[model samples]
Target chain A: MKRNKKMIIAFITPALVTFLVMFVYPVIRTVIMSFFKVESLTASTSEWQFAGLDNYIGIWKTPIFRTSMINMGVIWLVGGVIVLSVSLLLAVILTSGVRFKSFFRAAIYLPNVISAVALAIMWIQYVFSKKYGMLTSFFRALGLDNLAKISWLDSDMKFWAMLIAFCFGAVGYYMLIFLSGIEQIPQDLFEAATIDGANKMGQFAHITLPLLKGVFKTNLTFWSINTMMFFVWSKMFSPVETEASTISPVVYMYNIVFGTKGVTQRDAGRGAAIGVTMALFVLIIFFIFNRVLKDDDLEY
Target chain B: MKKKVISAVLCTTMAVAMLAGCGSNGGAKSNSTSKATSAASSAAESTSAKSKSTEPAKAEGGKNLVYWSMWNETEPQAEVIKDAIEEYQTESGNTVTVEWKGRDISTIIQAALDAGETIDLFDEDYQRVGQQYASKCMDLEDMAKAADYETHSVEALPTALRGWAGSLKGIAYQPYTSGIFYNKAMFKEAGIEKEPATWTEFLDACKKLKDAGYAPLVQDDAYVLYSYGFQIARHLGQDGVVDLCKNGGWAESEGALAAAKEIQSLVESGYYSEYAPDAYPNNENEIGYENAAMIVNASWVPSEITNNTKCDIEWGMFNYPTVDGGKDPATVANVGAQAFAIPDNSKNGQAAFDLIMKITTGAFDQKMALDTQSIPADPTNEEWPEMIAGCKDAFNALTNVYDWNMGLNTDADLKTVIQDNLMKLFEGKMTAEEFIAAVDAASK
Candidate 1:
């Protein structure tokens, strides 16, 4: 027993030290700095104190923060559902004893290997350009040049366009995850279903999906987290002076803390308040989501 | 009793060791090399300079810096900066390790800023300058007033550039200047004789090009739209309007409204080539594939848009298409210079500052043009591509500053209002009048 205790201590020490130094220290520092107003960049060195929960209360009243929360939640739902559903469907289709399965698998998984910046550029340049985009050129070749030069990222369809690019780039990884889950299923169950005269569709609905519940839960949870971290993508995607779309909770927190291109005093307390609020909200959201989505346990 | 004894002993040893570690060693030849460079650069500026910035790094010696850049718009210039650093390291063996944050300074830059932490040196966006001033996050005056002040000559920067950096509160880097970049071949194909000198002719030319199966313009809607609106605002508010807009909500009221109307008309008229919203192009694209004959972009686009893409573009530039009877023909040509600042908490401040001064103010300009093929800051460089340098007068005629609110001017509520309601206008969810009302409501 004593030896086990020592072993556990040895294993846990590094992580514990890391958490205290990296995570705990920063959080405490940020929470404390969330108060006090910046006079000028170099003039202040003092760690300013709190002026009540003004930082926390103030963020709630700001429309930007509110909109970000709404948009982040929506992106989580929409991006998660679309990527998961489509990729899972593709994984199953390729795995259903089909010809050229390996080729199809490689093609499906190709995009995830490419960097997001590179993928984003390719989508803009060769794929969507009304002039040179293969898509636009095909239309022009058919003499429907009016459709050429259409701006995909304009206000009319900017969000959808961004969503499409993000989903398309991300589907490959999700497909592989779903494929692994599909592979782990017992072949005997499908055979049993066949003997009972259940069609392919019936076998899929009755056995495949129900049995893949654990994977789906894991996939959706991760997807939600990824979508929620949208700041960098949103800023990159927006035109100057226009608003950003990928402003996740993290982005909003960042903007509040560091300030933005052309506005406001640094409110560290408010930024911390936003961070605290987000963490708590994320927890609440996960709880509500699991409660709503959790079905009966599926035996292996 | 045993746990207490161990804890007490470990804490004392570790704490003492950490304190010692933070204090960098002074006994190195590399430190002497850095000191020598600082001395040589100082001698170049003046003989009688008394700035104490000549001192070696004081906070802690031989500090490690984690620097990130968004994305370097030009690969050649990126190469030049990289080579220069490598050269510096070879010459002095004092290295500041770099990590690219992103292509456009948005990725790691945003993360760093949001983290509310001190960074050693970074290519921060010009827009962040205003916020830094307001939030007291940056110190331009201090950055410009360093010890070797004479040699680096930061104080000698163009007033217009300095003013744009939000100099009063924080130090904002001077940004790229916006100009009109057009396809020369497209002009000939449309049978237009010369660059438009008046707004009527500009629109007529665009209309003709539209009819000739070419997009007259393309909207990136990703980075330059609101800036485009700011440029247009200069034209709409003629006759001392720049001053008027800065002093009051006259810009947001009448100025932003007019610009909004112009954007709507552009959308309705079908003169634009659109890219996807998420696209941040650091390289060649189909637009330069001769899609739209022209684009309104900053100084760096010359490097970013050419050489890589296989477009045989014969490019030419014009001033902001002449505004009607405008007092000043100059519309705002955005100047977004990313400034490198030393954080108050940085231990490597002196070394980083010395390096920054050497890199930005010296061979970096020539290196930039040669490496990236972009326009050079130093006018003396003969290597500049004719397309960019030949029409210098026309380009210089464009305004260089944003010329809006500063000094307690906060963009928080204003930016929020615009982001929310502006989308509706772009999405066909709101009209020009509605946008006007939205601005008015926001201002009040």
Candidate 2:
């Protein structure tokens, strides 16, 4: 037994070392970097200055950072609700004795297969284009001349347009997860619910919904993760210059580190601070999900 | 147990080998040398004897000169320079290896230099040398003097360098500037005789175009700060705006408020196209498609107009118009350029310097101007595209040139505030006072 145990340990050692080198080391290093006044993200250690809480203080003082945080919050909360509700609905409809189940499922999941950049570009150029866009043409077809005249890609409406496009792509992915969860819930539960004189809606609420609590938690976690990484869409939608309406913390961090859009200075410490803040945000959401959504797994 | 030990050893060896294999290629030196030796020997057997007496450096053991061009082959300037490099190699019997890294050359150069890689030569904006890569760049004042670059160009090397890097650090590869490009047919239809010279005339032209049932001005949100900054430059001199940035006294400055008020009036007057907020290239597309009359764009717009669109409309350009009660002269244009810098780690610094000299001086500037359809930095070079000839007059009459507002402002937060509020002002979301106040608060 001792020789077998030693042999097992020997096999696991390489992977353990790799995990430490690849993930754990960088996380710790980033946390350390947040406290310093780093000139460049790629700068050597000696170039870093001990800035303490100054980087955090500086970010909080900037109104754009606050706007970015608020924009992210909206995308997280509002976008989360829309994506989850739509995806759940689609999942229920597809799984509920629907003909062409495979075709519908594949069609819904198609957007997920395309890259985020390509999807965002397609929406910006084809759908949101002011002159002859799909939205404009549709509005005109409906005889809504005023709506057709309104610039969808402009500052006031750009965020919503981007959010809608994002949700369109996001729903397909989450719906697949929900569909799988629905499939696992046995037909026995539905039969039992029907015998108890419950309607289809009642069975969905009492039997289908409760059993999919675990999947909900999983979907919610993934949604939060996606919201935190919200960058490419914001980057693609916004102009060359950063706008308050569309700025995300991740996008702000990118511009800060890169010194883009006329930002002459690069501060890696502040970027790391933003990173730490984002991680904390994800952690808080994770903990809240774990605490509030607790349920025992229903056995067959 | 013996079998297990052998398997473990084999696994570790394979992993280490995989990691070790991801190292440098060193292709620049070897590939360039081999190509040069074969190519040079074939072309220059007879001429090498005569050229060896005049230029000993030309009769060299295959010297590998590496250059990273900031533009890809798609850009006319890059093509012209690449041809020149090929000509230089064949004539001088020296080896040159060039990498067309495009706009992402900064990140590539930074990574290569940080890794202590041989970064012999690279082209980037002049400001980058002083702002970020000063430590890695070699001063080119002696080289510029040797090449007599100042006498040929309209602006001296120090003058051009100061606009970007604040000091002489690199040599100008080519001159590129920004101004307003208008549709001549549209102007003629609006009954506007010529390009506007002052604020009043500009406003009048805009109104005339609107009355003539046309979108007077078309601009993207991306360039809002730049368009507004030119107005600010007119009100406050370049130094005053710089002072505003340093002192955070934007709220106190009448010039800043005046600049905002002007843009607010334009927005209120409905001079901008409905598609003004569209992303870049799209706004230019509007102008190209005759959906709008004019656009404030960079020198590259002329080339982009032909390439990106198929419209057969005649194009004309004018400098940013003068303002009423302005501090600076109307001829003051916003000028910038693409330049080359030699890295301190360069193995062939002299060769790299000579390459730049060869490209920018003599008939090269004229050839570049004609090929690229851009104005020559050398005011002496009379060659220009007929469409851009009027702009050359404005360029020649320039009393001063300031960097674009977006590029000039050093404070990132204030820059963001300026761009956001200006965009809001154009969208009628914020007033002039609110825009200035927001910028002031952010600056503080």
Which candidate gets the maximum DockQ versus the true structure? Answer: 2
User: Which lDDT tens digits does candidate 1 get at residues B1-444?
Assistant: 687567666656765665576553312111123443454454434433333543322322234554444444244544555655554443333555565544445433434454555566666554554434224234445544654443433232334434544453322222245556777878898988878866678788889888878878754444443433444445553323334323446335555566667666766777665432224452125456676676666656654677556566667776665455443355444444555555445555555665554455446655665555455544443455554653456544544344322111235545555555555564445777787686556555
TM-score of each: 0.72, 0.90
lDDT of candidate 2 over B1-444, digit per residue (tens): 797888688767856764566454433322334446666675455443322111223434356677777887677887788767776676556777777777777656665766656766778776665567666677766656655667766674358575455555676646766678888999999999989988899999999999998899887877888888788888887788878877788889898899899988998899988767566768777777786787877777766776778777677878888788888777776776666788877877766766666676556767888887777756667878765665777677777777657233667766777777787888888999998898888788
User: For the second chain of model 2, what is the TM-score against the true structure's chain B?
Assistant: 0.87
TM-score of chain B of each: 0.64, 0.87
lDDT of 1 at A145: 65
Kindly give the stretch of ten consecutive residues in candidate 1 chain A with the minimal lDDT sum: A36-45
Best by lDDT: 2
Each prediction's whole-model lDDT (CA): 0.58, 0.77
lDDT per residue (tens digit) for residues A247-282 in model 2: 899999988876773445778899999999999999
**CAPRI category for model 1:** acceptable
Docking class of 2: medium
